[model samples]
Target: MRHDDDGLIAADALDRVTWAMRRAEWAAQAWKDQRLRPLGLAAAQYTLLINVHSDPGLTGAELARRLNVTPQAVASQVTRLEERGHLERRPHPRHRHVQELHLTDAGREILRDADAVIVEIERQIAEKLGPEKTSQLRALLDEVADAVRAP
Candidate 1:
């Protein structure tokens, strides 16, 4: 049995899947190092902040679900953010045992700074891949995400 030199069978769907996974990992690390670390935020923390900003009253469990993480993990990150003065926990309107998450004024300001870093990273990627190709790549990735998330 001869192995393909490219380590992929011709026209194999798994080839694209494997490539996409590796590319995503590499891109995430690069973005984190080049864009997020300088902002004094880890990628997870940044993601949490963005989620809370977008959904200001989400509970810890809701955030975990949205982020595909465990509630404990979300709670830990939330605790850190609250300690940093970037987030606040308020009594849930209807749930006596749960609290809703909100971004503090500092959180909003930090998010704006993070957005600038993200925009700059996107701009750099666009320059490397060109606008048309970058847009196409994003659309293709979105399709992949939708397909993977379909139940």
Candidate 2:
């Protein structure tokens, strides 16, 4: 495919929109990786940690559902975090088969530092997009996601 003026591969309008969304996701992940690497986390791992920290007692299955990932994938990340002593799986109070996730002290500390990185990234993006445009972009993106999820 030939590239358009913006250097994105040329396609029909809808395809170009999808391509732009994909590129934006990729670029965001790359930027997150650059910031997270020095903090001893990958972007995916950081996301997992943050989710567990935010939702304190979610099981792997629950997290997978929330993240739109497979349970197996969430389980693997949980295993890695457990091995690193960043998180722990405790017996669920209500169910025999379910285990509740909790962040250890290290996990909390790392997440606190990661939040600073996330804030700085948001600031940079807002500066690049301009405050008004950034807010508009966020609303438009949320609308896009909501539209895709609509039946």
Candidate 1's C-alpha lDDT?
Answer: 0.87
Summarize candidate 2's per-residue lDDT along 1-151 as a digit string, tens digits: 7545664634476568777999999999999999989998888888999899888999999999998999999999889889988899999998998999999998998888988998999899999999899999999999999999999
lDDT of 2 at 63: 92
Query: For model 1, how does the per-residue alpha-carbon lDDT over 3-102 read when each residue is reduced to its tens digit?
Result: 6667464767656876878887788667766677777787788889999998899999999999999999999999989998999999998989999999
Per-model lDDT: 0.87, 0.90
How do all models score by TM-score? 0.84, 0.88
CA displacement after TM-score superposition, residue 76 of candidate 2 (Å): 1.3
For model 1, state the Cα shift of residue 140 in Å: 0.7
Alpha-carbon lDDT of model 2 = 0.90
Candidate 2 residues lying further than 4 Å off, grouped into runs, are 1-15
